[model samples]
Target: MNPLYQIFVDPFVQMAGAPDLFAQTIWEGFVGGMLYALIALGYVLIFKASGVFNFAQGIMMVFAALTLVGLHEMGVHAYIALLLTLGVMYLLAVGVERAVLRPLVNQPDIILFMATFGLTYLLIGAGELVFGGNPKTMIAKELGLPSGGIDFNILGGLVSLQRIDIAAAVIASILVAGLAAFFQYTRVGRALRAVADDHQAALSVGISLNEIWVVVWFAAGVVALATGVMWGARSNVSFALQIVALKALPVLILGGFTSVPGAIVGGLVVGIGEKLGEFYWGPLLGGGIESWLAYVIALAFLLFRPHGLFGEKIIERI
Candidate 1:
Protein backbone atom coordinates (compact mmCIF):
# COMPACT_ATOMS: atom_id res chain seq x y z
CA MET A 1 0.00 0.00 0.00
CA ASN A 2 1.25 3.50 -0.81
CA PRO A 3 2.22 5.54 2.28
CA LEU A 4 -0.31 8.31 1.54
CA TYR A 5 -3.16 5.85 0.93
CA GLN A 6 -2.18 3.81 3.94
CA ILE A 7 -2.05 6.91 6.14
CA PHE A 8 -5.32 8.44 4.89
CA VAL A 9 -7.58 5.60 3.75
CA ASP A 10 -6.50 2.44 5.51
CA PRO A 11 -7.49 3.34 9.06
CA PHE A 12 -11.06 4.30 8.15
CA VAL A 13 -11.38 1.22 5.96
CA GLN A 14 -10.28 -0.90 8.89
CA MET A 15 -12.82 0.85 11.13
CA ALA A 16 -15.58 0.21 8.60
CA GLY A 17 -14.52 -3.40 8.29
CA ALA A 18 -14.62 -3.99 12.06
CA PRO A 19 -17.38 -1.86 13.43
CA ASP A 20 -17.51 -3.77 16.70
CA LEU A 21 -13.81 -3.19 17.28
CA PHE A 22 -14.30 0.47 16.53
CA ALA A 23 -17.11 0.70 19.04
CA GLN A 24 -15.09 -1.13 21.65
CA THR A 25 -12.18 1.22 21.15
CA ILE A 26 -14.47 4.19 21.53
CA TRP A 27 -15.93 2.82 24.73
CA GLU A 28 -12.52 2.22 26.21
CA GLY A 29 -11.45 5.72 25.24
CA PHE A 30 -14.57 7.23 26.83
CA VAL A 31 -13.86 5.46 30.10
CA GLY A 32 -10.24 6.57 30.13
CA GLY A 33 -11.23 10.09 29.16
CA MET A 34 -13.69 10.31 32.04
CA LEU A 35 -10.93 9.44 34.46
CA TYR A 36 -8.69 12.08 32.94
CA ALA A 37 -11.50 14.58 33.25
CA LEU A 38 -11.84 13.75 36.91
CA ILE A 39 -8.18 14.55 37.46
CA ALA A 40 -8.41 17.70 35.36
CA LEU A 41 -11.44 18.75 37.39
CA GLY A 42 -9.23 18.89 40.48
CA TYR A 43 -6.93 21.33 38.74
CA VAL A 44 -9.84 23.41 37.50
CA LEU A 45 -11.41 23.69 40.93
CA ILE A 46 -8.28 25.15 42.52
CA PHE A 47 -7.29 27.33 39.61
CA LYS A 48 -10.75 28.80 39.32
CA ALA A 49 -11.07 29.59 43.01
CA SER A 50 -7.48 30.43 43.92
CA GLY A 51 -5.72 31.50 40.72
CA VAL A 52 -3.04 28.92 41.33
CA PHE A 53 -2.02 26.12 38.93
CA ASN A 54 -1.71 23.60 41.79
CA PHE A 55 1.29 21.59 40.75
CA ALA A 56 0.57 19.32 43.69
CA GLN A 57 -2.86 18.13 42.55
CA GLY A 58 -1.47 15.01 40.88
CA ILE A 59 0.47 14.02 43.97
CA MET A 60 -2.57 14.87 46.07
CA MET A 61 -4.53 12.20 44.16
CA VAL A 62 -1.81 9.64 44.78
CA PHE A 63 -1.59 10.63 48.43
CA ALA A 64 -5.34 10.39 48.90
CA ALA A 65 -5.43 6.89 47.40
CA LEU A 66 -2.50 5.77 49.45
CA THR A 67 -4.13 7.10 52.57
CA LEU A 68 -7.32 5.15 51.91
CA VAL A 69 -5.50 1.92 51.15
CA GLY A 70 -3.24 2.42 54.15
CA LEU A 71 -6.16 3.01 56.45
CA HIS A 72 -7.87 -0.13 55.17
CA GLU A 73 -4.66 -2.05 55.75
CA MET A 74 -4.87 -0.97 59.38
CA GLY A 75 -8.16 -2.90 59.76
CA VAL A 76 -10.52 0.00 59.14
CA HIS A 77 -13.67 -0.82 57.17
CA ALA A 78 -13.54 0.24 53.54
CA TYR A 79 -16.32 2.80 53.92
CA ILE A 80 -14.85 4.01 57.15
CA ALA A 81 -11.51 4.35 55.53
CA LEU A 82 -13.11 6.39 52.77
CA LEU A 83 -14.68 8.81 55.24
CA LEU A 84 -11.44 9.08 57.16
CA THR A 85 -9.66 9.81 53.92
CA LEU A 86 -12.01 12.71 53.28
CA GLY A 87 -11.34 14.01 56.75
CA VAL A 88 -7.64 13.73 56.16
CA MET A 89 -8.00 15.64 52.91
CA TYR A 90 -9.98 18.33 54.70
CA LEU A 91 -7.29 18.67 57.35
CA LEU A 92 -4.72 18.87 54.61
CA ALA A 93 -6.69 21.66 53.00
CA VAL A 94 -6.74 23.58 56.26
CA GLY A 95 -3.07 22.98 56.87
CA VAL A 96 -2.21 24.17 53.39
CA GLU A 97 -4.32 27.28 53.81
CA ARG A 98 -2.75 28.24 57.10
CA ALA A 99 0.84 27.18 56.59
CA VAL A 100 1.31 27.76 52.89
CA LEU A 101 -1.35 30.01 51.41
CA ARG A 102 -2.20 32.46 54.19
CA PRO A 103 1.28 33.83 54.66
CA LEU A 104 1.69 34.19 50.92
CA VAL A 105 -1.67 35.85 50.34
CA ASN A 106 -0.43 38.80 48.33
CA GLN A 107 2.55 37.06 46.75
CA PRO A 108 3.15 36.73 43.02
CA ASP A 109 1.53 33.85 41.15
CA ILE A 110 4.94 32.26 40.60
CA ILE A 111 5.50 32.14 44.35
CA LEU A 112 2.19 30.37 44.86
CA PHE A 113 3.04 27.96 42.07
CA MET A 114 6.39 27.25 43.70
CA ALA A 115 4.68 26.78 47.06
CA THR A 116 2.62 23.97 45.53
CA PHE A 117 5.82 22.39 44.30
CA GLY A 118 7.10 22.32 47.88
CA LEU A 119 3.76 20.92 48.98
CA THR A 120 4.08 18.12 46.42
CA TYR A 121 7.43 17.03 47.77
CA LEU A 122 6.22 17.37 51.34
CA LEU A 123 3.23 15.15 50.63
CA ILE A 124 5.38 12.63 48.81
CA GLY A 125 7.76 12.37 51.72
CA ALA A 126 5.03 12.23 54.33
CA GLY A 127 3.01 9.66 52.37
CA GLU A 128 6.01 7.44 51.89
CA LEU A 129 6.90 7.71 55.55
CA VAL A 130 3.39 6.94 56.73
CA PHE A 131 2.18 4.46 54.12
CA GLY A 132 5.55 2.99 53.20
CA GLY A 133 6.85 3.01 49.65
CA ASN A 134 4.97 -0.04 48.42
CA PRO A 135 2.18 -0.65 45.97
CA LYS A 136 -1.17 -1.61 47.53
CA THR A 137 -4.52 -2.97 46.34
CA MET A 138 -7.44 -0.58 45.89
CA ILE A 139 -9.98 -2.65 47.93
CA ALA A 140 -12.53 -2.33 45.16
CA LYS A 141 -14.44 -5.42 46.25
CA GLU A 142 -14.81 -4.17 49.78
CA LEU A 143 -15.86 -0.77 48.43
CA GLY A 144 -18.64 -2.43 46.32
CA LEU A 145 -17.23 -1.46 42.96
CA PRO A 146 -18.09 -3.93 40.17
CA SER A 147 -15.55 -6.51 39.10
CA GLY A 148 -16.89 -8.25 35.97
CA GLY A 149 -17.74 -7.07 32.50
CA ILE A 150 -20.56 -7.52 29.96
CA ASP A 151 -19.88 -8.62 26.42
CA PHE A 152 -21.85 -7.94 23.27
CA ASN A 153 -21.60 -9.59 19.87
CA ILE A 154 -21.83 -7.29 16.89
CA LEU A 155 -20.60 -7.37 13.31
CA GLY A 156 -19.04 -10.75 13.97
CA GLY A 157 -16.89 -9.34 16.76
CA LEU A 158 -17.08 -9.00 20.53
CA VAL A 159 -17.30 -5.76 22.52
CA SER A 160 -16.70 -5.96 26.25
CA LEU A 161 -17.68 -3.32 28.83
CA GLN A 162 -16.41 -3.37 32.36
CA ARG A 163 -18.95 -2.67 35.06
CA ILE A 164 -16.41 -0.68 37.08
CA ASP A 165 -15.67 1.63 34.16
CA ILE A 166 -19.38 2.29 33.75
CA ALA A 167 -19.68 2.98 37.44
CA ALA A 168 -16.68 5.30 37.35
CA ALA A 169 -18.16 7.25 34.47
CA VAL A 170 -21.52 7.57 36.21
CA ILE A 171 -19.96 8.59 39.50
CA ALA A 172 -17.73 11.14 37.81
CA SER A 173 -20.66 12.62 35.93
CA ILE A 174 -22.68 12.97 39.12
CA LEU A 175 -19.79 14.53 40.98
CA VAL A 176 -19.25 17.07 38.22
CA ALA A 177 -22.94 17.97 38.20
CA GLY A 178 -22.99 18.33 41.96
CA LEU A 179 -19.97 20.59 41.83
CA ALA A 180 -21.57 22.69 39.11
CA ALA A 181 -24.64 23.14 41.30
CA PHE A 182 -22.50 24.03 44.30
CA PHE A 183 -20.55 26.66 42.40
CA GLN A 184 -23.66 28.16 40.86
CA TYR A 185 -26.12 28.23 43.78
CA THR A 186 -24.19 28.35 47.03
CA ARG A 187 -23.04 31.43 49.00
CA VAL A 188 -19.52 30.05 49.38
CA GLY A 189 -19.42 29.39 45.67
CA ARG A 190 -20.28 33.00 44.89
CA ALA A 191 -17.58 34.15 47.24
CA LEU A 192 -15.12 31.83 45.51
CA ARG A 193 -15.98 33.29 42.12
CA ALA A 194 -15.53 36.77 43.45
CA VAL A 195 -12.13 35.87 44.89
CA ALA A 196 -11.12 34.26 41.64
CA ASP A 197 -11.94 37.46 39.80
CA ASP A 198 -9.93 39.63 42.22
CA HIS A 199 -8.59 38.71 45.64
CA GLN A 200 -8.34 42.29 46.90
CA ALA A 201 -11.79 43.11 45.66
CA ALA A 202 -13.25 40.06 47.36
CA LEU A 203 -11.56 41.02 50.62
CA SER A 204 -12.81 44.56 50.26
CA VAL A 205 -16.36 43.15 50.04
CA GLY A 206 -15.91 41.42 53.46
CA ILE A 207 -15.15 37.95 52.16
CA SER A 208 -12.52 36.27 54.32
CA LEU A 209 -9.68 35.19 52.06
CA ASN A 210 -8.44 32.63 54.57
CA GLU A 211 -11.82 30.96 54.75
CA ILE A 212 -12.22 30.91 50.96
CA TRP A 213 -8.76 29.43 50.45
CA VAL A 214 -9.53 26.60 52.84
CA VAL A 215 -12.86 25.95 51.15
CA VAL A 216 -11.43 25.77 47.63
CA TRP A 217 -8.49 23.64 48.73
CA PHE A 218 -10.85 21.31 50.49
CA ALA A 219 -13.00 21.15 47.37
CA ALA A 220 -9.94 20.29 45.28
CA GLY A 221 -9.03 17.62 47.82
CA VAL A 222 -12.46 16.02 47.50
CA VAL A 223 -11.99 15.87 43.76
CA ALA A 224 -8.57 14.29 44.26
CA LEU A 225 -10.02 11.60 46.51
CA ALA A 226 -12.67 10.63 43.98
CA THR A 227 -10.14 10.48 41.17
CA GLY A 228 -7.84 8.38 43.34
CA VAL A 229 -10.53 5.87 44.20
CA MET A 230 -11.68 5.31 40.62
CA TRP A 231 -8.22 5.17 39.14
CA GLY A 232 -6.87 3.06 41.98
CA ALA A 233 -9.60 0.51 41.41
CA ARG A 234 -8.52 0.24 37.80
CA SER A 235 -4.87 -0.26 38.73
CA ASN A 236 -2.74 -0.77 41.83
CA VAL A 237 -2.51 2.16 44.21
CA SER A 238 1.06 3.37 43.84
CA PHE A 239 3.18 6.47 43.54
CA ALA A 240 3.58 5.72 39.85
CA LEU A 241 -0.07 6.58 39.37
CA GLN A 242 0.93 10.24 39.81
CA ILE A 243 2.66 10.06 36.44
CA VAL A 244 -0.56 8.97 34.77
CA ALA A 245 -2.41 11.70 36.64
CA LEU A 246 -0.10 14.25 35.02
CA LYS A 247 -1.88 13.65 31.72
CA ALA A 248 -4.48 16.03 33.13
CA LEU A 249 -2.07 18.83 32.16
CA PRO A 250 -2.78 18.30 28.50
CA VAL A 251 -6.46 18.00 29.25
CA LEU A 252 -6.32 21.35 31.06
CA ILE A 253 -4.48 22.89 28.14
CA LEU A 254 -7.02 21.60 25.65
CA GLY A 255 -10.07 22.42 27.74
CA GLY A 256 -8.80 25.59 29.45
CA PHE A 257 -7.37 25.84 32.95
CA THR A 258 -10.40 27.47 34.54
CA SER A 259 -13.41 25.93 32.77
CA VAL A 260 -15.14 22.94 34.35
CA PRO A 261 -17.04 21.91 31.22
CA GLY A 262 -13.88 22.35 29.21
CA ALA A 263 -12.14 19.69 31.28
CA ILE A 264 -14.82 17.12 30.39
CA VAL A 265 -14.80 17.89 26.67
CA GLY A 266 -11.02 18.11 26.50
CA GLY A 267 -10.62 14.79 28.28
CA LEU A 268 -13.01 13.06 25.89
CA VAL A 269 -11.25 14.45 22.85
CA VAL A 270 -7.81 13.46 24.14
CA GLY A 271 -9.02 10.06 25.24
CA ILE A 272 -10.83 9.17 22.01
CA GLY A 273 -8.27 10.74 19.72
CA GLU A 274 -5.33 8.94 21.32
CA LYS A 275 -7.00 5.53 21.35
CA LEU A 276 -8.09 5.85 17.72
CA GLY A 277 -4.68 7.15 16.75
CA GLU A 278 -2.86 4.28 18.41
CA PHE A 279 -5.15 1.61 17.05
CA TYR A 280 -5.19 2.98 13.50
CA TRP A 281 -2.00 4.94 13.05
CA GLY A 282 0.39 3.26 15.47
CA PRO A 283 1.42 0.48 13.13
CA LEU A 284 1.99 2.96 10.36
CA LEU A 285 4.31 5.16 12.44
CA GLY A 286 5.45 2.44 14.86
CA GLY A 287 3.88 1.47 18.15
CA GLY A 288 4.01 3.52 21.43
CA ILE A 289 1.92 6.28 19.89
CA GLU A 290 -0.50 6.25 22.80
CA SER A 291 2.02 7.86 25.14
CA TRP A 292 2.80 10.96 23.10
CA LEU A 293 -0.30 11.37 20.95
CA ALA A 294 -2.12 13.38 23.62
CA TYR A 295 0.69 15.93 23.88
CA VAL A 296 0.72 16.29 20.09
CA ILE A 297 -2.99 16.97 20.03
CA ALA A 298 -2.54 19.43 22.92
CA LEU A 299 0.25 21.16 21.03
CA ALA A 300 -2.03 21.53 18.04
CA PHE A 301 -4.75 22.99 20.23
CA LEU A 302 -2.21 25.37 21.79
CA LEU A 303 -1.20 26.62 18.36
CA PHE A 304 -4.78 27.21 17.28
CA ARG A 305 -6.73 27.98 20.48
CA PRO A 306 -4.28 29.11 23.12
CA HIS A 307 -7.02 29.98 25.59
CA GLY A 308 -8.47 26.50 25.07
CA LEU A 309 -11.87 25.49 23.78
CA PHE A 310 -13.83 26.87 26.73
CA GLY A 311 -11.38 29.39 28.21
CA GLU A 312 -12.08 33.11 28.39
CA LYS A 313 -9.96 35.54 26.44
CA ILE A 314 -7.94 38.09 28.39
CA ILE A 315 -7.55 41.54 26.92
CA GLU A 316 -5.41 44.23 28.54
CA ARG A 317 -5.24 47.95 27.73
CA ILE A 318 -1.93 49.68 27.98
Candidate 2:
Protein backbone atom coordinates (compact mmCIF):
# COMPACT_ATOMS: atom_id res chain seq x y z
CA MET A 1 0.00 0.00 0.00
CA ASN A 2 1.13 3.56 -0.70
CA PRO A 3 2.32 5.34 2.47
CA LEU A 4 -0.20 8.16 2.27
CA TYR A 5 -3.08 5.83 1.37
CA GLN A 6 -2.11 3.44 4.17
CA ILE A 7 -1.87 6.31 6.61
CA PHE A 8 -5.30 7.77 5.88
CA VAL A 9 -7.42 5.39 3.80
CA ASP A 10 -6.61 2.08 5.44
CA PRO A 11 -7.81 2.98 8.92
CA PHE A 12 -11.28 3.92 7.70
CA VAL A 13 -11.48 0.72 5.68
CA GLN A 14 -10.55 -1.30 8.73
CA MET A 15 -13.26 0.45 10.78
CA ALA A 16 -15.84 -0.35 8.13
CA GLY A 17 -14.69 -3.93 7.93
CA ALA A 18 -14.91 -4.40 11.71
CA PRO A 19 -17.89 -2.46 12.95
CA ASP A 20 -18.05 -4.36 16.25
CA LEU A 21 -14.51 -3.42 17.13
CA PHE A 22 -15.33 0.20 16.32
CA ALA A 23 -18.37 0.16 18.56
CA GLN A 24 -16.46 -1.55 21.35
CA THR A 25 -13.71 1.02 21.10
CA ILE A 26 -16.25 3.82 21.38
CA TRP A 27 -17.84 2.26 24.47
CA GLU A 28 -14.46 1.86 26.14
CA GLY A 29 -13.60 5.46 25.30
CA PHE A 30 -16.89 6.72 26.76
CA VAL A 31 -16.21 4.92 30.04
CA GLY A 32 -12.67 6.25 30.26
CA GLY A 33 -13.84 9.76 29.34
CA MET A 34 -16.43 9.72 32.12
CA LEU A 35 -13.71 8.94 34.64
CA TYR A 36 -11.57 11.78 33.30
CA ALA A 37 -14.56 14.12 33.55
CA LEU A 38 -15.02 13.05 37.16
CA ILE A 39 -11.47 14.06 37.95
CA ALA A 40 -11.75 17.35 36.04
CA LEU A 41 -14.94 18.15 37.94
CA GLY A 42 -12.86 18.35 41.11
CA TYR A 43 -10.70 21.01 39.52
CA VAL A 44 -13.72 22.93 38.22
CA LEU A 45 -15.44 23.02 41.63
CA ILE A 46 -12.50 24.69 43.33
CA PHE A 47 -11.56 27.01 40.49
CA LYS A 48 -15.10 28.25 40.13
CA ALA A 49 -15.65 29.01 43.78
CA SER A 50 -12.20 30.17 44.87
CA GLY A 51 -10.74 31.47 41.59
CA VAL A 52 -7.63 29.45 42.36
CA PHE A 53 -6.48 26.54 40.25
CA ASN A 54 -6.00 23.63 42.61
CA PHE A 55 -2.81 21.74 41.85
CA ALA A 56 -3.48 19.34 44.72
CA GLN A 57 -6.81 17.97 43.54
CA GLY A 58 -5.16 14.93 41.92
CA ILE A 59 -3.28 13.99 45.08
CA MET A 60 -6.45 14.55 47.09
CA MET A 61 -8.05 11.73 45.13
CA VAL A 62 -5.20 9.38 46.01
CA PHE A 63 -5.19 10.51 49.62
CA ALA A 64 -8.95 10.07 49.94
CA ALA A 65 -8.76 6.55 48.48
CA LEU A 66 -5.84 5.64 50.70
CA THR A 67 -7.68 6.94 53.73
CA LEU A 68 -10.64 4.74 52.94
CA VAL A 69 -8.47 1.66 52.34
CA GLY A 70 -6.38 2.45 55.40
CA LEU A 71 -9.48 2.72 57.57
CA HIS A 72 -10.84 -0.52 56.19
CA GLU A 73 -7.51 -2.21 56.84
CA MET A 74 -7.86 -1.08 60.44
CA GLY A 75 -11.10 -3.13 60.63
CA VAL A 76 -13.67 -0.46 59.89
CA HIS A 77 -16.68 -1.51 57.80
CA ALA A 78 -16.59 -0.45 54.17
CA TYR A 79 -19.54 1.93 54.43
CA ILE A 80 -18.23 3.28 57.69
CA ALA A 81 -14.83 3.73 56.18
CA LEU A 82 -16.45 5.68 53.37
CA LEU A 83 -18.24 7.98 55.83
CA LEU A 84 -15.04 8.41 57.81
CA THR A 85 -13.20 9.25 54.63
CA LEU A 86 -15.72 12.02 53.98
CA GLY A 87 -15.17 13.28 57.50
CA VAL A 88 -11.44 13.24 56.98
CA MET A 89 -11.87 15.22 53.77
CA TYR A 90 -14.10 17.67 55.63
CA LEU A 91 -11.44 18.17 58.26
CA LEU A 92 -8.93 18.64 55.50
CA ALA A 93 -11.10 21.35 53.97
CA VAL A 94 -11.35 23.14 57.29
CA GLY A 95 -7.64 22.80 57.88
CA VAL A 96 -6.93 24.24 54.45
CA GLU A 97 -9.27 27.13 55.08
CA ARG A 98 -7.63 27.92 58.41
CA ALA A 99 -3.98 27.18 57.82
CA VAL A 100 -3.56 27.77 54.10
CA LEU A 101 -6.33 29.84 52.56
CA ARG A 102 -7.41 32.22 55.35
CA PRO A 103 -3.98 33.74 55.89
CA LEU A 104 -3.45 33.99 52.17
CA VAL A 105 -6.72 35.76 51.48
CA ASN A 106 -6.21 38.69 49.06
CA GLN A 107 -2.87 37.26 47.99
CA PRO A 108 -1.91 36.91 44.33
CA ASP A 109 -3.32 33.94 42.46
CA ILE A 110 0.18 32.50 42.06
CA ILE A 111 0.58 32.52 45.83
CA LEU A 112 -2.55 30.46 46.28
CA PHE A 113 -1.49 28.11 43.51
CA MET A 114 1.84 27.56 45.22
CA ALA A 115 0.07 26.94 48.51
CA THR A 116 -1.75 23.99 46.96
CA PHE A 117 1.61 22.63 45.85
CA GLY A 118 2.75 22.61 49.46
CA LEU A 119 -0.53 20.99 50.48
CA THR A 120 0.05 18.25 47.91
CA TYR A 121 3.41 17.33 49.42
CA LEU A 122 2.01 17.56 52.93
CA LEU A 123 -0.75 15.10 52.06
CA ILE A 124 1.70 12.77 50.31
CA GLY A 125 4.05 12.65 53.28
CA ALA A 126 1.21 12.17 55.73
CA GLY A 127 -0.40 9.47 53.59
CA GLU A 128 2.89 7.65 53.28
CA LEU A 129 3.52 7.81 57.00
CA VAL A 130 0.01 6.69 57.89
CA PHE A 131 -0.94 4.26 55.10
CA GLY A 132 2.54 3.13 54.14
CA GLY A 133 3.81 3.35 50.55
CA ASN A 134 2.30 0.10 49.36
CA PRO A 135 -0.48 -0.46 46.85
CA LYS A 136 -3.77 -1.68 48.36
CA THR A 137 -6.96 -3.19 47.00
CA MET A 138 -10.16 -1.19 46.88
CA ILE A 139 -12.93 -2.97 48.79
CA ALA A 140 -15.25 -2.91 45.83
CA LYS A 141 -17.06 -6.11 46.74
CA GLU A 142 -17.63 -4.93 50.28
CA LEU A 143 -18.77 -1.58 48.99
CA GLY A 144 -21.36 -3.33 46.75
CA LEU A 145 -19.88 -2.23 43.41
CA PRO A 146 -20.71 -4.83 40.79
CA SER A 147 -18.16 -7.11 39.18
CA GLY A 148 -18.11 -9.24 35.97
CA GLY A 149 -18.46 -8.48 32.29
CA ILE A 150 -21.34 -8.52 29.84
CA ASP A 151 -20.83 -9.65 26.26
CA PHE A 152 -22.82 -8.53 23.25
CA ASN A 153 -22.79 -10.03 19.77
CA ILE A 154 -23.08 -7.46 17.04
CA LEU A 155 -22.02 -7.26 13.42
CA GLY A 156 -20.64 -10.79 13.68
CA GLY A 157 -18.28 -9.97 16.52
CA LEU A 158 -18.22 -9.91 20.31
CA VAL A 159 -17.95 -6.78 22.43
CA SER A 160 -17.44 -7.20 26.15
CA LEU A 161 -18.39 -4.57 28.75
CA GLN A 162 -17.52 -4.39 32.41
CA ARG A 163 -20.27 -3.85 34.94
CA ILE A 164 -18.06 -1.54 37.00
CA ASP A 165 -17.49 0.73 34.01
CA ILE A 166 -21.24 0.98 33.52
CA ALA A 167 -21.64 1.83 37.18
CA ALA A 168 -18.92 4.46 36.94
CA ALA A 169 -20.66 6.02 33.96
CA VAL A 170 -24.02 6.10 35.74
CA ILE A 171 -22.55 7.45 38.97
CA ALA A 172 -20.51 10.13 37.20
CA SER A 173 -23.53 11.24 35.18
CA ILE A 174 -25.63 11.58 38.33
CA LEU A 175 -22.90 13.57 40.04
CA VAL A 176 -22.54 16.03 37.15
CA ALA A 177 -26.31 16.40 36.88
CA GLY A 178 -26.76 16.86 40.61
CA LEU A 179 -23.99 19.42 40.72
CA ALA A 180 -25.38 21.31 37.73
CA ALA A 181 -28.79 21.46 39.32
CA PHE A 182 -27.27 22.56 42.60
CA PHE A 183 -25.41 25.39 40.93
CA GLN A 184 -28.44 26.39 38.89
CA TYR A 185 -31.28 26.10 41.41
CA THR A 186 -29.95 26.40 44.96
CA ARG A 187 -29.24 29.58 46.93
CA VAL A 188 -25.84 28.40 48.15
CA GLY A 189 -24.93 27.38 44.64
CA ARG A 190 -25.92 30.81 43.40
CA ALA A 191 -23.75 32.32 46.10
CA LEU A 192 -20.87 30.21 44.90
CA ARG A 193 -21.36 31.48 41.37
CA ALA A 194 -21.57 35.00 42.65
CA VAL A 195 -18.22 34.59 44.37
CA ALA A 196 -16.75 33.02 41.26
CA ASP A 197 -17.87 35.98 39.22
CA ASP A 198 -16.57 38.72 41.51
CA HIS A 199 -15.28 38.35 45.06
CA GLN A 200 -15.69 41.98 46.09
CA ALA A 201 -19.15 42.16 44.58
CA ALA A 202 -20.23 39.00 46.38
CA LEU A 203 -18.91 40.28 49.70
CA SER A 204 -20.63 43.62 49.15
CA VAL A 205 -23.91 41.75 48.82
CA GLY A 206 -23.37 39.74 52.07
CA ILE A 207 -22.04 36.47 50.64
CA SER A 208 -19.53 35.11 53.14
CA LEU A 209 -16.26 34.49 51.33
CA ASN A 210 -14.78 32.34 54.08
CA GLU A 211 -17.81 30.10 54.26
CA ILE A 212 -18.06 29.80 50.50
CA TRP A 213 -14.40 28.84 50.22
CA VAL A 214 -14.90 26.06 52.73
CA VAL A 215 -17.95 24.80 50.90
CA VAL A 216 -16.21 24.65 47.51
CA TRP A 217 -13.15 22.90 48.88
CA PHE A 218 -15.30 20.35 50.68
CA ALA A 219 -17.27 19.78 47.50
CA ALA A 220 -14.02 19.25 45.60
CA GLY A 221 -12.99 16.73 48.23
CA VAL A 222 -16.24 14.86 47.78
CA VAL A 223 -15.60 14.77 44.05
CA ALA A 224 -12.08 13.48 44.70
CA LEU A 225 -13.42 10.68 46.88
CA ALA A 226 -15.87 9.54 44.22
CA THR A 227 -13.15 9.64 41.53
CA GLY A 228 -10.80 7.68 43.78
CA VAL A 229 -13.37 4.99 44.46
CA MET A 230 -14.19 4.43 40.82
CA TRP A 231 -10.60 4.54 39.60
CA GLY A 232 -9.36 2.47 42.53
CA ALA A 233 -11.92 -0.24 41.84
CA ARG A 234 -10.74 -0.38 38.23
CA SER A 235 -7.11 -0.66 39.31
CA ASN A 236 -5.14 -0.89 42.56
CA VAL A 237 -5.34 1.97 45.00
CA SER A 238 -1.94 3.59 44.70
CA PHE A 239 -0.34 7.00 44.63
CA ALA A 240 0.52 6.31 40.99
CA LEU A 241 -3.11 6.93 40.20
CA GLN A 242 -2.35 10.62 40.68
CA ILE A 243 -0.49 10.53 37.41
CA VAL A 244 -3.59 9.37 35.62
CA ALA A 245 -5.60 12.06 37.37
CA LEU A 246 -3.30 14.65 35.84
CA LYS A 247 -4.91 13.92 32.48
CA ALA A 248 -7.68 16.10 33.77
CA LEU A 249 -5.44 19.06 32.91
CA PRO A 250 -5.92 18.50 29.23
CA VAL A 251 -9.60 17.86 29.87
CA LEU A 252 -9.79 21.19 31.65
CA ILE A 253 -7.99 22.95 28.83
CA LEU A 254 -10.29 21.48 26.24
CA GLY A 255 -13.49 22.11 28.22
CA GLY A 256 -12.45 25.45 29.82
CA PHE A 257 -11.34 25.69 33.43
CA THR A 258 -14.61 27.24 34.62
CA SER A 259 -17.17 25.29 32.63
CA VAL A 260 -18.67 22.18 34.25
CA PRO A 261 -20.37 20.71 31.19
CA GLY A 262 -17.24 21.58 29.23
CA ALA A 263 -15.38 18.98 31.29
CA ILE A 264 -17.74 16.21 30.17
CA VAL A 265 -17.63 17.18 26.51
CA GLY A 266 -13.88 17.72 26.57
CA GLY A 267 -13.29 14.40 28.29
CA LEU A 268 -15.41 12.57 25.76
CA VAL A 269 -13.54 14.23 22.88
CA VAL A 270 -10.15 13.39 24.34
CA GLY A 271 -11.20 9.90 25.29
CA ILE A 272 -12.83 8.95 21.99
CA GLY A 273 -10.28 10.75 19.80
CA GLU A 274 -7.30 9.12 21.47
CA LYS A 275 -8.78 5.62 21.38
CA LEU A 276 -9.61 5.92 17.72
CA GLY A 277 -6.22 7.43 16.93
CA GLU A 278 -4.30 4.75 18.78
CA PHE A 279 -6.33 1.89 17.36
CA TYR A 280 -6.14 3.12 13.80
CA TRP A 281 -2.88 5.03 13.61
CA GLY A 282 -0.76 3.41 16.29
CA PRO A 283 0.64 0.79 13.96
CA LEU A 284 1.48 3.53 11.51
CA LEU A 285 3.30 5.52 14.18
CA GLY A 286 4.80 2.41 15.86
CA GLY A 287 2.25 2.31 18.69
CA GLY A 288 2.28 4.17 22.06
CA ILE A 289 -0.02 6.82 20.60
CA GLU A 290 -2.56 6.62 23.40
CA SER A 291 -0.26 8.34 25.85
CA TRP A 292 0.39 11.54 23.86
CA LEU A 293 -2.64 11.83 21.62
CA ALA A 294 -4.68 13.69 24.22
CA TYR A 295 -2.05 16.37 24.59
CA VAL A 296 -1.90 16.78 20.84
CA ILE A 297 -5.64 17.27 20.66
CA ALA A 298 -5.43 19.72 23.54
CA LEU A 299 -2.69 21.63 21.77
CA ALA A 300 -4.88 21.88 18.70
CA PHE A 301 -7.74 23.22 20.78
CA LEU A 302 -5.41 25.71 22.39
CA LEU A 303 -4.34 27.01 19.02
CA PHE A 304 -7.86 27.39 17.69
CA ARG A 305 -10.01 28.04 20.76
CA PRO A 306 -7.89 29.11 23.69
CA HIS A 307 -10.85 29.74 26.00
CA GLY A 308 -12.13 26.23 25.24
CA LEU A 309 -15.37 25.03 23.69
CA PHE A 310 -17.69 26.18 26.47
CA GLY A 311 -15.55 28.68 28.33
CA GLU A 312 -16.60 32.31 28.44
CA LYS A 313 -14.10 34.71 26.96
CA ILE A 314 -12.76 37.35 29.30
CA ILE A 315 -12.33 40.88 27.98
CA GLU A 316 -10.43 43.64 29.76
CA ARG A 317 -10.26 47.36 29.11
CA ILE A 318 -7.09 49.28 29.69
Residue pairs clashing in model 2 are none
lDDT of 2 by residue, 90-172 (tens): 99999999999999998999999999999999999999999999999998999999999999987889999999999999999
Scanning candidate 2 in windows of ten residues, the lowest lDDT window is 308-317
Model 1 lDDT per residue over 117-192, tens place: 9999999999999999999989999999988999988778999999999999999999999998988899998998
lDDT of 1 at 257: 91
Candidate 2 segments whose C-alpha is farther than 4 A from its true place: none
